[model samples]
Target: MSYDDLMAMRPGVTFDARGEAQVLVWAPKAEKLQLQFGEEAKMLDMEPKDYGFWTLQTRALWPGDRYRFLLDGKGPYPDPATLYQPEGVHGPSEAFDLQEYEWSDRNWKNPSMKDYIIYELHTGTFTEEGTFAAVEAKLDHLVELGVNAIELMPVSQFAGDRNWGYDGVFPYSTQNSYGGPAMLQQLVDACHEKGIAVILDMVYNHLGPEGNTLGHFGHYFTDKYHTPWGDAINFDDAWSDAVRHYFVQNALMWFRDFHIDALRLDAVHAIKDFSPVHILQEIRQQVDALVRETGREHYLIVEMDLNDTRFVKPIEAGGYGMHAQWVDEFHHALRVSSGQERNGYYVDFDGVASLGKSFRDAYVFDGLYSDHRKRKFGIKADGIPGQQFIVFSQNHDHIGNRMLGERTSQLVSFEMQKLLAGTVFVSPFVPLLFMGEEWAEPNPFQYFVSHTEEELAEAVRKGRKSEFAAFHLEGEAPDPMAVSTFENSKLQWALIDQPPHGTMLQYYRQWIVLRKSQQLLRECDRNGLSVEVFGEKELLCIQRVWGRQHLVAFLNFSKSSQEVSLPFEHLSWHKLMASSDSAWNGPLEMPEQAEAGALTVAAESITVYANIINS
Candidate 1:
């Protein structure tokens, strides 16, 4: 069938023949569907579709048309596919001409995956204003923190102003609550200007329940596979070609249209497809082709539960060739050693052996049997360089999805926090810090959404409570609908003045300085990495060497004061880069001897000592 004929049967009005037009919606279910074009008002025909969709096509539709769909024929609803919502999430969706924005980052390209220090952040909680522009103010801080890129949480338009952004339904639209497309451009513009790159987290595995209107237009989802959220996206089922195209197009939009440096595909394990050419492989090939064509550094990162190195292996080498994946091994090992919390996956890693194994060999499980999973899980990453993995102490899911929305600080001592930070940032792997982690923001990053339908909102509130109940902390779960949920999640910028917060910030700055200044931490060769245990079950010593420079990372997991002798009998200690303590905390001091190689480290602390003598 011709494209025009196919468009006729679709529920909502899609693009015109020229692929250059604006769309209008007038759903009766919407209280109102009025169109506000920056300033002008165009009353929509709230015509109901036999398939339950309302749509309108206008020739005047061009890029930069700011408009909102009025629900109930009167209330304003952000466009499901709004390219830009200049106003925050509550405002109208604007028709954005992606071609108009001038990019000055010609030399900008994807940095080596193994050399990255990633910072994962949610737009809503990253700043008080919770807009793209607000984050622009913090670009320098991230750059100074030694992060190569900022991995933003999903930014696609979702149901409400305060969502985590994963439940987004409109894959093509920027979240209006976060200053939409134009604002996103400004953020990217500023990031490139500061020598920092942006990586967007995208969710294509499933769509949110409330605002997902794709069903009315096409079979975007199917029952062949089930995800925790709901029906899985139709990637191999009938009419799945269109569904696959939708996602592929969206992926290109972020890189080509929005000038995004990279995209972090969320939960690839949840995406089920039976096609001969896996959609992910197809995407990787396309992105690689784009890189060749444009000569811009572009990359596709995946968040895969499977420890298959195929994700990062080159496609020609019989692998997927994804640039990087988040390493849960790092998080599990460190959390097990530091927090001593043995719940869920943490059940497998409470032993010091796991921490040592993780430090020595990047993966704790490493193809071994997982008792909790009741199967042999995880593949060995010994040959893979650490930079291909994104390691972190805490992230949105680790904290926000928790029953109480507790951060790493809630579970571990302040000393351990420093140790954890050092472990991640100094390791050969790429590191990521969740928002507010730099200064330890007190706000909880919980699940929050704004739904226009009262019934949908109530249902969400109940589901959230039940979801957390499985952890046995349901009573402490914050109400999803409560205004306090959103309010409490806001970062209190004032915390920067506090003692631990201020100190931690300074500690991060020092760590970044050392990371940049030192050669050992920047080493990307897997063969150059090595580790040795100092104490059997209390402290661990890891040494990374590149060329002649050697960096010894000392980590003490125990609470009580304990000490251990260092390695390298032929060398002397040079200098201590950072410690968990400051002089103000209790006479914090560097190692006594300024010699080159061997030394002793304290308990509940992480120390970085260098060897000045050339090898």
Candidate 2:
């Protein structure tokens, strides 16, 4: 609408007098814009501003009010800030009242940082139906497995039927096929009823390739900085305040309107802001205030590669005050210790000492010289509590971005997989289990996307092929848009009852149970955490302690049995709680006695011993 023509229309109903909610949309390109709320349309008068933003006020949109925006006096346009897209990503917005739905977890509160066992799952592929109801049925399973929280991959509306959701275009609207806004509420409501918290993964670094209309409405993107995806967001440029507000507002809406427990920010290293007060700090302050007002504890977790402890430290101590950060160093160290090839980032992490250092301080580099970047990188995360770091063996990035999307199941032996899980879960950090890792689903978690534009689709296909050329594979890279790509990635639930799958599932369940029952292992303290290297650089002994709870973790990375000596007395007489051996599905048949203060740890096996007995 022409800027002046949009200002000539007036609303039929008074909003502020009736205490109804109001909204203003800016669209300088349209000839005219009007509100299409059911049969009676309201004309909006746009207020002229320096940045060409159109303004208007409206009465509160109650539940079941179907609405759309009319541009240039033509047809209707989906709201740029739509909350629900019932018909899919291409449909009109539906007014959803948050108070209509009854919540069953009114008194339920989330577990503290020190008491979280996270389960990461992708909603689209988590179940056969790929809907909220399907995932809701599995809540009891997570609670049974002792996971306190569920971290879902980005659920924002993207352009395709299948995606990793890093390319989301609509930040406010929930994905349509995944059952939209109401379905998400139901899912969270069910989780809370089962004493499980929900943490949503959100991306603010870049928008999707298509269906992104923020640029057409106002100044959203700036050329001040550049990201690998495209132009960076204008956090410090002209009209950047509004752009920043758009994101923070969206974040608060998720917590306030939808009752989300927390939000996991994706790739914070790519976010650019050079203002006096960083955008992250601003977001932290606002969220903190919201928590105080609502009388509920909400968290903001960020995924960063900078290895700076300030991201997780408190604001009072001159830090960004985020609840936690995904610690990639732990993943890299475990992967290299398991004999993984030096791929892109793995080049900096191929030593047993690196693994030891990560276990000791939670970061392998710790400000040391890096061979990959040819510069010193990463600071020591010594004083930071282990709970502030979310550690995992494998995530979507590690599996899907690989040349063929080979999971840990395809690369390492069954024993090694269990050994790696033992190493991670027994650490002081908050442990996370990737979807299907419990049962070792054999299918590759390959990267897949569907582009609506033909040229963009071709570009994505060609780019994917070229990206994997360095791997020197023999076959053609599968088309990401093909139905087989999505179908091949689905979890084979029936596999859990098979041979190796059954063994892996039992190992995970048993380890999780031990992690819960063992007092020393449950305490997330760095003071008593120590590691003893053995097996001529192939074996490791990890010890963790909190108060009266003391645990010794034995791991042998090689394929042959080895004897690892302990530093403490009575260690020789320790009992085994978990083993990765295929033949010996349970613990060792022998007594819990050691020979001459030494323990016999099987090759590619992991065993945990509790020093303090139960009352």
Candidate 3:
């Protein structure tokens, strides 16, 4: 199929072969469908097409016009493929021309997977203004931090202005509260202009509960599969072709229309599909075609909790052909080593030993018995490259899902916080930083929502409480319905200039600079990497060699200084950056040189050394 044909696959306000836009709706359940235009609700009959598609080719709708669908003279509802829901999810859908945006990113090129230093942030809370334009204004902060990509959490249209955005019922429409599709266009354009790529998180496993009208139009969901949120999307059941096309086109929309560099598929393990060609593979096939046509690189990153290598492996290797995936094992192991309370999944890890194994093997539980699950979990990810996994110390889910929503910086010691940041930079994977983590912002990222229905609101409150009942953490889980919960999640941008916060910011910036400048550290080289764990001392050493160059990191996970060996070919090893150094307000004054064999690293700190010749 041509690019235009692929764009037209989505049944709503899509451009034709001649490049003129038209309204098309797919309401398989509706006997008759009509178009309701403007505030006057002027009704116009829509001719039903062959397989439940409704179209009104005669009545042309322009950008900025408000409209909705009337199924069989029933009350009006928002379009399933609405481009902009200016009046919220329950209200009328406004038309916004997706193709009209004059992009300035023509000269921009997507960065390589290995070069991706991603910073994940929610659009609603990244800034106090809580809009896409506000996020663009913070580009200078991100540019200074040296992250090449920004991963915005799901931005689909949700119930109200305040949400983490996962509750969005409309998949195509950009959240109106966050400046709609137009502002999102501007953010993408501005990000590319600054040499930054955008990775949009898309939730396709299940739609949100509020304003969920897809069932009224078509069989978009099925009862066969169950997800944590609700019923799984209809990907393999009867009338699954239209459902598959709807989502595949949605993925294409992000890449083709919005110029998104990568899509982080949220929780692909929950997507139950018994079809020969899985939904994810089909999306990849169409995206590959689009890439050939546009001559630009696009990526699909999956968040599969299963730790299945088949998702990231190539299609030729009997996999889903995904570019990369968020590997939570690294994060879990790192967190456990950093002294996070052994609760929930943390109970399964053995601290530094797990972290050490994760460095060697991509998955810590690769075909091993998982005590948390009481069963064998995760197949071996032996052949996968490190760049195929995205690792983070703290992400939205990690922080927000906590009982009191405490950030890693708040829970761990100050020294451990810096140590965690350094470890991520030195890891053999694409590193990610959650918003406000660099500066140790003390604000909590509690779960919050603005659902209008009181019953739904009460259910959310109960659900949040039930999730962390096992953790046994000392504080009451914040009310999910409270506006304060959302307000508290916003990043305190001004904290970057404060004393310890400012110092932490410098530590992160310098670590990133070091990683980017060094040849061996720039990307993962499993062939030339070695990890050693000292269980008694809680010390982990990682050695990386590329050709003739050699670098080593000594990570002390203990609360006290630990003696470590630094074997070197030369008589002496040059001391590199260290969190224990006085530059970061630590006890140790880093020397120009270090003894080749033995050294004592500071408590909860990460120190690096290079051979005298390489240094």
Candidate 4:
């Protein structure tokens, strides 16, 4: 194959016009390479090419045939670009063809980032079967919840069956335990049929430790730079061109093959690349090329800890062309406001005032001094739009990383949960929800892993314990390796039929409906909203005005009722919905106020009103 042909798609199993399977691999370090295929384990010598690439073709290879490459005759390792691993990550790589699956979502156009209400869920905990088909069966619940986009946690092939999906060795292959690529394709088709876009979470900074043998092939890792996981990927070192191409092809494969609408790049801050053209920009350029070719909108969303707006800015503006990035400041501020224990990163946030700043500025720590960091952190995002930041009250890291793995419902009052949901939905930025948060699922989303090696499992446990020693919580954290820990994390789907759980679901549904119905909320313009904090009363007031629609939301974080005076008494503000209303199963107590035009906000509740006079 020519260089142009190699650049077109990821190098993997492909059938030629003669119906023979051909494979290409890059192994510059290897003096010799061989391939073993089929149940008979037939070995074939790979022809060395000029560009440090090895190629081989065989008529015996079938769709389900398993193969592995022998590098320098040391050992046979799984193909790095394998499409399907029918067995676990350590097992032989199975041959797969993208042409095998008949996709029905040809006309699917991705929803705009501004219009996305993303619901992030782990497939294992999302349903009882823990398969992609199982998730597809539950699509109706997401559609009814008003989420136009579903961000799935990483589904790549990891070490074991029960994992959070972060310890994935095969980036291109779907988790075999989750029904592999075929079931995933069916799920994407089902999601599109229900008008919900799919966003896949991809980890590119480092591959998992176990069952990963990329270093055996070439210099895929660099000792020049370091990451929390281990050695960083070689993006700017010698023999780095093929390494870059490998990951870029991974990104393109997800979009072009699976029809994934967007990719949520996991922990981009750790991607140490000093090249003139960043890996992110190259990804953006290629994705744009794909969009032009297919006439489908695709997005690249990143999760970075820095308060840098360059990722979301356009490429021509000397910034990475990322459609959006996760903004964790909103979550921290909201959690602190609701009386969460101030420790770790939460020490920097100062309750209601921080929450208010997130509403108006979208980036709370934009060049502001952080007490926790003991220095000024974050670049000022002066003119960034609200849609560029994705905010959520609860996500996998928020709940699962906790020592006790307690959800927001477990940490705060039921009314506070409602208030949190209202604050997220009413905000100008996009809102994301963790699985089972709508019905206040009592199950804790504890982090769980099922690595086959006992030594690695013990190391993970010790590391987790040492990390949480600073928090100084009461009891010991749950055992991440235990089956009970994984089982306990599953969402109780039947809880929505119960009393308080069902009522909380209704309250969440109302907020979602209101957010979609009101143009003021959907505008996602930073200039359209104003936020005020009444520190003494632990109250926040968010005022939004768009065209003839004027809306005001009063959020009370205190344990007692607080009355906030209306900003403009001249405008007749009619009550739209109060989370403390009886219909939502709140106490429904009407607090007595001495002054007129004072809005009584219930304890740990959110109250919104519309200006009827403006209309």
Model 1 segments beyond 4 Å from truth?
1-59, 64-81, 84-94, 107-109, 534-536, 580-588, 592-599, 612-615
Candidates ranked, most accurate by lDDT first: 3, 4, 2, 1
- Which portions of model 4 show Cα errors greater than 4 Å? 1-5, 16-18, 589-596, 612-615
As for candidate 2, its clashing pairs are 1-29, 1-30, 1-31, 1-32, 2-30, 2-31, 367-378, 520-549, 572-594
Write the residue-wise lDDT of candidate 4 on 1-615 in tens digits: 676665564677777656788887888889999888877888989888766777777887878889998988978899988888888988999998776778888778787888899999999999988999899999998888888999999999998889998899888899999999888988998999899999999998889977988889888899989999899989888878788888888888888889899999999999999999999999999889988998888899999989988888999998999999998999999999999999988899989999999888878899999988999999888888888889999999989889989999899888899889988988889999999999999899998999998999999998889888767766788999999999999989988889899998888887888778888888888887888889998999888888888787889999999867776656656666788888888876443222237666789998888764443
Candidate 2 lDDT by residue in tens digits, 244-327: 767777788788767888899999999988887777888889888888998878889999979898788888888888998898
Q: Cα lDDT for residue 333, model 2?
A: 80
- The better candidate by lDDT, 1 or 2, is 2
TM for candidate 2 is 0.91
The 10-residue segment of model 3 with minimum total lDDT is 1-10
Alpha-carbon lDDT, every model: 0.72, 0.77, 0.88, 0.87
Expressed as tens digits, the lDDT of each residue in 1-615 for candidate 1 is: 344433333222245447545453323234334454546666545444432344455666566566665554444566655566455445666676666667777666567665566788888877878889889987877876667789899998877687888878777888877877778888887888787779999997888876666564457788999998888999999767656666776787788767899899999999998787778888888787777888887788888778787778878877778888887777888887785567766777755677678766677777898988889987777667667777788888878778778788777777778888888877777778887888877677887777767998888888877776545552656777776787788777788779878888878777777766677776655576667664454777777778877767777787765555556577776665657445425225665454544344556778777776564
| Candidate 4 root-mean-square deviation in Å | 2.1
Which scores greater on TM-score, model 1 or model 4?
Answer: 4
